[model samples]
Target: MTQTFDPPPPDVVLDPEREASLRTIGVISYALHAVVAIGALLPGVQASIVLLIVAVIVDLVKRDEAVGTWQATHFSWRLRSVLWCGILYVVTIPLWFLFVIPGWIAWCLISIWFLYRIVRGWLAMNDRRPMPR
Candidate 1:
């Protein structure tokens, strides 16, 4: 019997240049997130908010181009991570006024969560896999 093979679907195939560009963008974005995450985990190191803002802006502007691609999930994932972390930190602000220890604990937990997300997303990107929705 003769062997038969079928080509992958169009969506599963990506242009080489386009894929390279997307990967480059993903690397830059992940790098920015890692820096901020590292800073949050350290007591004295402070990552600039500007780095995050820049990352967000780059993601927003390039996200549309990544539509219909696996990289799209990464863009959304990073954005959602930032949004959720910001909201959680803001919501916990009252804890600072009421109890300093609780506030510190809450922030530490949030920071750990933020770092986890960054590391997970970065690893997924490096593996060339799509992030879970």
Candidate 2:
């Protein structure tokens, strides 16, 4: 017998409250990323590290509830995507310490990628079909 796979329906509707929460999280994450990028350009490694720590804290708070909701709703793939993006960003930081300019560029690219994934997943979660890639 042959088996077929079907995409699960969205677990949560995009109400005004959820939309507001998503926008808030997006803004916070973007701001934290911007600060980290700018801090990397400064003289000391301490600034970059401090900014990175702040970013991580912000990330944890922002995603904690969302992760729980996703798990409870069986949207585990979305959670995995978010987690992978975080991991990629973390791995790129030390590289920035080695070769400043190139590392910063790479970091920026990775940051953009993270934002893309977050927005994409958010849309997917809400069952909003994103535009073509």
Candidate 3:
């Protein structure tokens, strides 16, 4: 007669302190992004580039630390959002020199999209859920 063996259980242990720290970092990053996004959407209200830079720096630095955790997706989502927004803005720069109205319109749409991404990500983070890939 042959005997059947059961597979081992997966590791489910987590460090509570580390998780709390990661969540706090996520909140700070989201807050900074929200401020920048709102400022961009508003008329004549310039958001400080310094804040964006700091948020980016925070995401880049702490991202690796959050690997294998749910928070990693948030870091990735924020970074991708910033990268895409910058690319879109640069691609539309010629519109500014060509047609003022169209350029303004393009930037407004992009700003709205950026704000949406920030809000969605922030909400997912608050709910402690991973962002949809």
Ranking by lDDT: 1, 3, 2
Off by over 4 Å in 2: 1-8, 42-48, 67-133
Tens digit per residue, CA lDDT, model 1, 1-133: 5533233347666899999999999999989988998898799999999999999999999998888788888898899999999999999999999999999999999989998998999998898888877
The TM-scores, one per candidate, come to 0.90, 0.42, 0.89
Q: Point to the candidate with the largest lDDT.
A: 1
Single out the weakest 10-residue window by summed lDDT for candidate 1.
Answer: 1-10
Off by over 4 Å in 3: 1-12
Residues 1-133 of candidate 3 have per-residue lDDT tens digits of 5533222134534489988999999999999998999999899898998999999999999998877677788998999999999999999999999999999999999989999999999998898787755
Q: Summing lDDT over every window of 10 consecutive residues in candidate 3, give the lowest-scoring window.
A: 3-12
Considering lDDT, which of the candidate structures 2 and 3 is the better prediction for this target? Answer: 3
Minimum summed lDDT over a 10-residue window in model 2 is located at 68-77
lDDT tens string, model 2, 1-133?
A: 5533333246744567865675565455545554554444445632455654565565555654544243222133333444675687688788778888877787667656655655554554446332222
Model 1, C-alpha of 118: deviation from truth (Å): 0.7
- For each of the candidates, the C-alpha root-mean-square deviation to the true structure, in angstroms, is 6.9, 7.4, 8.1
